[model samples]
Target: MVGAGIGGLCAAAGLQRAGVEVVVLERADEVRSGGSGLSVFSNGIRALDALGVGDAFRAVTTRTEGLRAGQRRPSGAWLSTLPADAVAELRVIDRADLHGLLSDAVTAGTVRTGRRVTSMYPNGLVESVGSGTAGARRAWDRFDLVIGADGLRSAVRTGWPEDPGVAYSGYATWRGITAAPVELRGEAGETWGVECRFGIAPLADGRVYWFGVRTAGIDEPGDPALLRELFGSWHRPIPELIDATDPAAMQYLPIEELSGDLPTFARGRAVLLGDAAHAMTPDLGQGGGMAMEDAATLVGLIAPFAGTECGDAPELLDEALRRYDELRRPRPQRVAARSRMIGRLAHAPGPLLCAARDLVVRATPAAALGRQAAWVHEWLLTR
Candidate 1:
């Protein structure tokens, strides 16, 4: 396994639980101790269950009834609201807390920190810069399989000729958490504007997690003051939440996703997973969830290869990987496409287009919206 982010760690947990010997290669010195937060839907919850960490995750996360989104005028009147039932059984977890959970679930000593993999070969040989060795690179022991759980710019994916490339989504996002002040209490939801959006949700503790997104250049810099100037007058808790955040804790990121023409997620003995395979827009909040699903699905498909007495282990492994690619590829790509379409519609640039977008949302019944979203949140792990 390469890269110890959410997807890689979860994959390690599932693979280890199946009695497979595993080692995770991460470039960071240690597991991330702090970061923003994430919202996981029922589908992600089910993936956690498949990985045997569902209870551990619930212990540190706050469960919400559903997802609610609406558009507001700059003056703060509701243009339209997606019904609360649109997304059922939602939960929010601080990224650090969830990372700690997955890290603990992995067998101790399996993760090698501060090691950067320079390249991986088709025969499962990984070359990495050894930690504290003054940048000396060496080949690690070969393995039966290699998983490219690395994020968007994955080394393993780059080594293969099949990779198409990555594309900029033309948007940027700022996320942070603040201690919930006395005035904030209630359900969680998102407020959308012409080309911008703000989301708010409560953590298990009293802190509230929020994110602000807008259409912008990929190289644009982010400023908290600019966020205030843009959204300060829009709504009551929105500005207040921004004001309450610790300035240093704010994180800014430019959104990007895999090209729609990504070739194959698998090549030879190595395979890609998570953002390495299908990076998607955050418009639907399923980026992390899809990665979790990928982890669970990958491990579930390959379990038979662990400690098998069959003579043709290599052929069996190849078949399992073929099945993994066949089963896992289409759904996430479809979801990515849907998320991109939603982002384009929500960030429509012209006044006439924005008004039409809001009008269509208002005219559409809540039940109809819920039905359209049901396919996303209703996913469950087969294992």
Candidate 2:
């Protein structure tokens, strides 16, 4: 595994559990100790269950009751409320907590931090900066199968020369977590307006995770004061949440999506997974969830070859990668497109369009949304 982020660590957990000898190399000096919270939907939980860490994850995370959507009225009120009962039960967790859980699940010494992978060959050979080596020294290591669980800026993907670059979405996002006062309590909710949206999900310990998104117009740097000036007038408690957050804790990410139509996930013994393959918009909160699903699927597909003779392993690995891509591609693409579309709709500027959107939200049956999400959450692991 290259890149010991969430995807890499989860991949390590899954492959190690399947009796595969795995070593994870991470470029960072340590697991990122701070990050925005995540919404782990039931589908993702199911994937964690398959990896045997669902319960452990649940122990540290808060299972969300559902989502509530509304519009901020000009009169400082909220209008057009809709609940998330239509979707599967979801949980909100801090990213640090999730990373810690995944890291703990893997055996000691399986992961090496600060060892950056500089390049990879087609035949599963990886070159990386050795420990204490100065000025980009090259060292080689080979594996029967190489899983690139590296993130969006993946060196492994670049090394293949087969992958395309990331395409920027027309939006950027600001995410942060604040300690929700003991008095305020609720499930997750989102407030929509012309060309802007804000979502808030409460963690188990009363810290509320919130995200603010708007259409990225150009290369302007993020201005938190401007964000507060723009969104401070939304519905109740949102202002409070924003005020509670420390300015330094906020993270700004320019949205980007995968545009290449890569036919195969592998070149020789190398395979890519997670953000290395599909880094989609977080509009649907499925980015991390999809990565977890990929990790689980890769393990199930490759387990049979763990102890098989060396000659047969390469063929089996190739077949597994083929199947993995086939199963994963459609769902993530559907999600990526849907998320982008929804974000566009939410950010529509015209009063008529906003009104029409509210009308649809008010009229659309929650059950319909539930059914759509069920298709995503109800994935059964195949042996």
Candidate 3:
């Protein structure tokens, strides 16, 4: 694995459990997640269970169910919500905590930090860079298979001649976790306004994870106070969430996703996974879930090779990878496209369009929204 992000670490855990010797090369000085929070939908929970980290994942977030979540206006009026049964599959977790859980699931010493992959091929030949002055030179390793989970700017994906690269979503977000436990007051979900949205949810540990988003340029001011300025007057706890967050820890991120289409995710003895393969806007909250699903699907396809030597089943591996591409690629692309559309709707350009959107969202039946939620959250991994 060429990256130690969630997708890569999850794959490492499963492969090691299947008796495969895996090495996860991470470019950072250490393995950690940068984001403040993540929404792990039902499919994601199932993926973690398949990857053998489900127990820890659930343990991190004790409140697995019963979150009455839906959209709200600036006045805090409920817009529309899936029925409790539909939303039962949703759980919010601190990204860093989940990262630690997945990291622990992997075998000790499996991830070599500060190692950057310079080049890779379909035949599993890899050239990596080290951190120190003496370690600057390229070092080579050949493996039975290579996986690129290196996020949006993946080196493995970059080497692909067909790669379309990434483009900004014309929006930015500020995410933060409360320094101390804050009372959720039984409130959760997103509050929407013109070009701005505030999402709030409680972590299992009582700390609240919140995110504020607005349609804007990447270089157009991203200060934490921008979140306050944009969302201060929206709602009650929304302001409290922002006030409780330390300014230094808040994250300002510009949303970006893959621009064009890639012919295939499986290329030679190497494959792309997670954001490396399909970097999507976070509008649908499926970015992490899709990555987890990818990990589980890829691992399940190769599970038959457990306890066998690497490269022992080249033709079979090729066939399985083909299937991986066929099975994994379409759903996420569809989801990504859907997310983009939702982002546009959520961040509609003008007040008139925004009003129309709010009216449509309000008039839509909760059950109708529930059905749509099922289409995204009810995914099953076929072995």
Candidate 4:
């Protein structure tokens, strides 16, 4: 395996349970020490359960009560209400905390950091740079299979240049966690305005997690004060939350998604997973969640070899990779399209369009709201 991000680590845990000896190579010198929070829905929690880290995740995370959220105009008027059931399935956890938990679950010595993959060969031979050196000193190692859990700009995926590259969603996002706990407004939800949106939720540690979205160039200026100016007057507690955040800790990025039309997620003995496969907008907060699903599903698909050593026959692994691609590709692409659509509606460009979106969202029944998401949240691993 290459790249020890969420999908890689969780996939390692699942693979170990299946009695597979795996080595994970990461480009970084150490596990990530910093990141914003992530919202894991029930499906993601189940994926954690399959990997045996659900309990650990619960210990460090908080359940968001009533997935109740709605769009709000600049004047702070409620524009629409999203009634959500399955409140127990939703949680907000700091990214670093979750990363630590997943990393700890993996067996010691399985992960080697500071090693960057230089290239992958057709016969599962992977070349990497020596520790502490980018690509100066090279070494070669062969494996039965290579799984790429690298992020959107993936080395493995880039091998297929004909595939459409990462598509920018014409928006940028700013995320930060409060240095200290601050009093919050609603249980947890978003407030939308013309061409912009603000979201707030609480973490288990009493600190609040929030994110702001707007339609802008990827290079738009991102200073804390500017964030304050952009959302300062939108609503209460929004300003206070911004003020409470540590300036240095905030994260800003241009939103981008992978082209839904990837020729294939599997190439020879190598396969792609997570953002490397289907990078999507954060609109549904399922990028990480879906990656967890990929980990579980990939392990489950290879269950026939759980107790047997099948490494001698590379064809068996090739067949498994094809199965993984067949079962995993379409759902996430559908989700990517849906998430992009929601981003468009939430960040409507004009008052008239925003008002129309508000009316449509307001008219939808709450039960219908739950049903709409049921398809995404109700997924279960059938072993």
The number of the candidate with the highest lDDT is 3
Each candidate's clash count = 0, 1, 1, 0
Better of 2 and 3 by TM-score: 3
What lDDT is reached at residue 24 by model 3?
96
Worst lDDT 10-window in candidate 4: 306-315
The lowest-lDDT stretch of 10 consecutive residues in candidate 3 is 129-138
lDDT of 3 by residue, 194-281 (tens): 9889988788888888989998887887878677678888878888889999898899889999997678998999999999999999
- Comparing 2 and 4 on lDDT, the stronger one: 4
Per-residue lDDT tens digits for candidate 4, residues 1-383, read: 98899999999988987788899989888878454888888999998898778999999987777545656666667765666564556888888888899888899999988888878865789988866644457789998788988889877777665456888898898899999998765545788877888888788888988998889987887777788778989777788888999889999889999865686788888888999899999998889988999888888876567656556555667778888888888878888888999998887888899888888877887787777677788878753
Q: Residue 12 of model 3: what lDDT?
A: 95
True-structure RMSD, every candidate: 2.0, 2.5, 1.6, 2.0
Q: How would the candidate models be sorted by lDDT, starting from the highest?
A: 3, 4, 1, 2
lDDT of 3 at 115: 92
Query: Per-residue lDDT tens digits of candidate 1, residues 171-267?
Result: 8889998855424446456677868878787777878888898889988889878889778877778898898898788999998887764667787
Assess the local accuracy of residue 206 in candidate 4 as a C-alpha lDDT between 0 and 100: 82
Determine the backbone clash count of candidate 4: 0
lDDT of each: 0.82, 0.77, 0.88, 0.82
1 against 3, candidate with superior TM-score: 3
Off-target runs (Cα >4 Å) in candidate 4 are 130-135, 310-315
Q: What's the TM-score of every candidate structure? A: 0.94, 0.91, 0.96, 0.94
Choose 2 or 4, whichever is better by TM-score: 4
Q: Top model by TM-score, which number?
A: 3
Put the candidates in TM-score order, highest first.
3, 1, 4, 2
